[model samples]
Target: MEIGLVGKPNVGKSTFFSAATRLEVEMASYPFTTIDANKGVGYIRNRCPHQDLEVECEPNNAPCINGTRMIPVKIIDVAGLVPEAHKGKGLGNQFLDDLRQASTLIHIVDASGSTNSEGEPCGKGEHDPRADVEFLTKEIDHWLKGILERNWDKVSRKLEVVGGNVEHAVYEQLSGLGVSEAMVVLAVRSADIQESPKNWSGDDLYRLAKAIRMKAKPMLISANKADLAGDDLMDSLMTLGDDIVIPTSAEYELALRKASESDIVEYMPGEDNFKVLRDDISDMQKSALDKIESHMKRYGGLGVQQTLEKAIYELLDMIVVYPVENEHSYTDKDGRILPDAHLLPRGSTAEDLAYAVHTDIGKGFIRAIDSRTDRVIGRDHELKDGDVIKIVSK
Candidate 1:
């Protein structure tokens, strides 16, 4: 699944991207520093079953780090969005189009209220961060509405006169946005527009667009620059109540990761604290680390990792399943223990897992053996989190 990092310019979008993916992108205090979208793979931690199985895992797709399995998730950092972005303002269309494949989005807002609506540097607490949230959602809603309004007369006439399926037609129009037919149906229902498509009002269209965007591209809020934010500002963001707001310090996270890379500190992404590995460190570096530790202690580990994990595990409702060729030994054909980790939605069936492993394996139509229980299960059997199964294909 792809997670799009979105926000106004200089709200640490690039810094968050760099920290999360360990890939360098241009970062600056000015708006629109990122002209092109940066794509990279970021990982979410999962418990490696090999630890429980008492076997050394030779991973392939994902790496196992000290008993923790790091499952890769695609991350795209798009250009900074400005107000009226849907109206083609400030790299508007490009930004929205870049997020077409994103299953979800992480909105990085300056919680310190240090950035204006245009993403320019402003006085602290000058701009309300909550307004940033509203504006971004509104821009997306308008963008989707514009897409739906295109050829609306012809399409709506076809839908009403030809008695075509409304959900399917809408789904077709928004297929590029990763919108599913199921999402269209739910959006239509939630929109509660009883009128026929031909007679639907502008407001009705906007409502439908909003609903579709809600389901098609769910979002999590990252209240960035939290270290510089006051509790009152943080409290205001929390009162948003609709989205999950996480306080993050991307600068601090980047610093910690860099320090870890240099072996100056023993740090883990999600850990609340780090250890200074070298005693000969400069006083200036030591002070910076101490401040970062204090901030991390207050907000819980820089919030960079937490935001990513919440987007995947909670927002996406994904679970990791291991497919093994040898159920008894929990190894692939090459004798590597639990080599691959597949992220599947909660309630995915054995047949689905087979398809995920390979189309040929799924086409063969097989039974599966659960390594944990050694019980033979049919193709329809639903898989659970951390399941290790051997596909017995014909």
Candidate 2:
């Protein structure tokens, strides 16, 4: 799953990316600082079963630290968006296109209201961050609307004349939008447009486009710059009612990660606090570390990790499953204990997981054994979170 770190420029998108992935990108105090997209792997922390199984796991593909398993997910930081981005305003055209690959978006909002609508720096609270919340989604909606509007007339005519499969026709029309025919059908239903396709009005098409964008690109807002934000600002943004808003200090996360890299302090990305490993520290560095500690005490961890975990598992309804060759050892062919932790959609079946591992394994068509009990299960056995299953195939 790919989560796009998106927002207007200079709202800490690059900072968040750098912190999460420990990969550096340009961060300037100007709009359009990111001209292209940067892709990297960012992990969500979970408990490694080895801690409970009384065995030490040799990590591969995923990272395990102090019994916490870090499942990596791809994150893309793209160009900033502005008002009427669908109309090609600012760097809107390139940025919107960059978003097509994202399964979900983490909108990094300048919750301090330090950036104006165009991402230009301004006094704190000058621009209401709540306004930033819906606009990006609307911009995305309008972008989809633009694509659908281009062919609405011709496509609707064909649908009306052909009169067999509306979903296929609409799906074909939006084949480039990264949505499926089932998604198109649901969008049409959600739009509540009961009339014939040819009879759809401009407003009807607008609603339909919005629905399509909603299902195609689900998003969670990260109320960034939270350290500088007032409670009133946070309260207002929270009232915008996405319930998925995560207050994040990208700057703090970056600082902590950087400090860890320098061995100045021992820190984990999502942990509530850190430990000063070395006693010999300068006064200035001590003050900075103390300030970070205070912030963590106030609002928990820096929130970069929380945003990612919520975006992937909560908003996207994903689960992590372990597939092992040796059920007892919980090891793969190479004797690596729990080397692979696959993220699958909730309710995925054993066969689906087999396919996820390899096409050949899935096609061979056999049952699976529940690792916990060694109980035989059918191909259709639904996998659950943390399930360790051994597939028996031809």
Candidate 3:
């Protein structure tokens, strides 16, 4: 699944991307630092594959190899959006097209309101971050509405043959928007469309548009620059009733990761603080690093790691399942233990997972054995997190 990182200009999109993937992109304190989309792999740490192996290690050091299983979720840092992005303003068509293929969007908001829509510094009291969210969401909804409006005549004609069901017509028209057939059915049902086209109001059209958007519309609010925003901002955000707001300091986290590589300070990305391993660094440098590190821990998480993972698993409801052969060794064809891990959608059955593994495995139509529990299950067995399954095919 691909997730697009989008927001108004200079809302730390590039910083979030850099921190999440550890790739260096041109991050400036200005708008449109990322004009083109930068794609990278962001990894989450699952329970160690060798955890059940009972290998011993020191505190803060696990015995398992630190290699991450790359599930290949494309993260696109698209160009910034302005108030009128839907109306061909501020690289309008380009930005929307970039996000057209994304399964979901992660809106990186400047909770501190340090920057304006143009990524310019404004007076402290003049910034309204909530307006940014409203504006961007409106643009997306309007853009989809425009697409539907343009094709309304053709779609309306098709409805006559399909029993005059506007929902079916709308789904047939919007199949290119990366919405799945099942999700389209849900969107149509939730839209409450009528049999007669004359009864459909502009509001109905808008609601239909919004539902299509929501099909791929799982968005996580990244309350960025939390260190600068303070507790009141976080408390205020929590009170707003958004379930997936994650406080993050992207810049500080990237710097800390850089520091770790240099061996100046031993720091984990999400840690509240760091341990100073060497005294050779200047006191001024150490103090600067310590301030950023401390800010990260108190507010929420250091980099975008915690935020991205929370968005993927908790907000998106995804689960990772390991497909392996050897129950004792937990190895794949290349003898690498749990080398291939598939992140499947929630409520995915064993048959669905079999298709993800390979068509042959799925076509054989057999059962699966949960290696962790040594329990055999049918093709329709529902999978949970961290499940290791051995497919028993014909």
Candidate 4:
């Protein structure tokens, strides 16, 4: 699954991306610093099952760091969005298109209110960060509504004549956005639009579109630049009901990672503290590290990693499963122990895992074996998190 990093320009969205993925991108203090989308591989942390099974892991797909499995997930840093983006203003079309494949979005807001509606630099607290959250949602909602409204009269008439399924028809319009028919059905149910598509009003379509966006592209808020924010701003963002807002300092996180890369500090992503490895560091560097530590102490570590974890594990409801060729040894064909880690949605079955592994393997339609229990499980058997299973295909 891919996660899209979206925000108004100059809010450190690129910084967040660099911090999370350790990939460099152009960053500046002005709007539209990122014109094209930057795609990189980020990771979701999971406990390595090798630890429980007491075996050395020779991981292939995901790396093991200190008994933690870092499963790779694609992250897209799209161009910054502005108000009325759906109306084709300020790289709006580019941003929307870039996010079509995103399973979820991380809205990075300038919690310090240092960026204005146009994403231009402003005095701290000059703009209401809450407006940033609300506007982005509305922009996406309107964009979806626009797509649904196109050729509505003709499409609805055809559907009415054929007595077609509204949910399926809507899904066809939004499938490009990675929206499933099941999600469309749920959105329709939530919308409660009683009228047939042919007679549905604009408001009805818009409500349905909003519901669909909510399901299809659920978002988590990264209240960035937290070091420059006040308690009032942070509290206000936190109280935005139903939105998961995490205080983050993308600048500080990037700094720490850069330090780690240079071996100046011993640090890991998601760690609450870091060790300064060198004592002969310049006073300027020491001062910067001291401030970051204080900030970490105040807000419980840099929220970049925490926000990614929440987006994948919480919003996406995903679990990591180990697929091995040998259930007994948790090894693959090359004899690499615990070779691969796959992230599947909660309640995914053994069959789904087979398909995830390979289409031919799934088509063979055989049973699977649970390595932990040494129990033979049918294709439909539900797999749990950290499951090490070997498919017995023909």
lDDT by residue for model 4 (1-394), tens = 7899999999999999988886222222212223334987777789999899999998777878778887778889989999999999999999999889899999999999999989999999999999998899989999999999997898899898877887888888876788999999999999999987899898998999999989989999999999999999889998998899999999999999999888899887888899999989999999999999999999889999999999999999999999999988889999989978999999999999999999999999689999999999998899888999999998
- TM-score of candidate 2 relative to the true fold: 0.94
TM-score of each: 0.95, 0.94, 0.88, 0.95
Cand. 2 Cα-lDDT:
0.84
Instruction: Supply candidate 2's per-residue lDDT for 53.
Output: 78
Looking at candidate 2, the ten consecutive residues that score lowest on lDDT are 24-33
Which one wins on lDDT? Answer: 4
RMSD of each: 4.5, 4.6, 5.5, 4.5
Tens digit of per-residue lDDT, candidate 2, span 341-373: 889989899999999999999999688998877
Q: Which stretches of candidate 1 lie over 4 Å from their true place?
A: 23-37
Per-candidate local distance difference test: 0.89, 0.84, 0.71, 0.90
Worst 10 residues of 4 by lDDT: 23-32
Model 1 lDDT tens row, 175-281? 78899899999999999998988988889999999999999899999999998999999999977977999999999999988998888998878889999999999
**Model 3 misplaced regions, further than 4 Å:** 23-37, 55-72, 161-165
Q: Is candidate 1 or candidate 3 better by lDDT?
A: 1
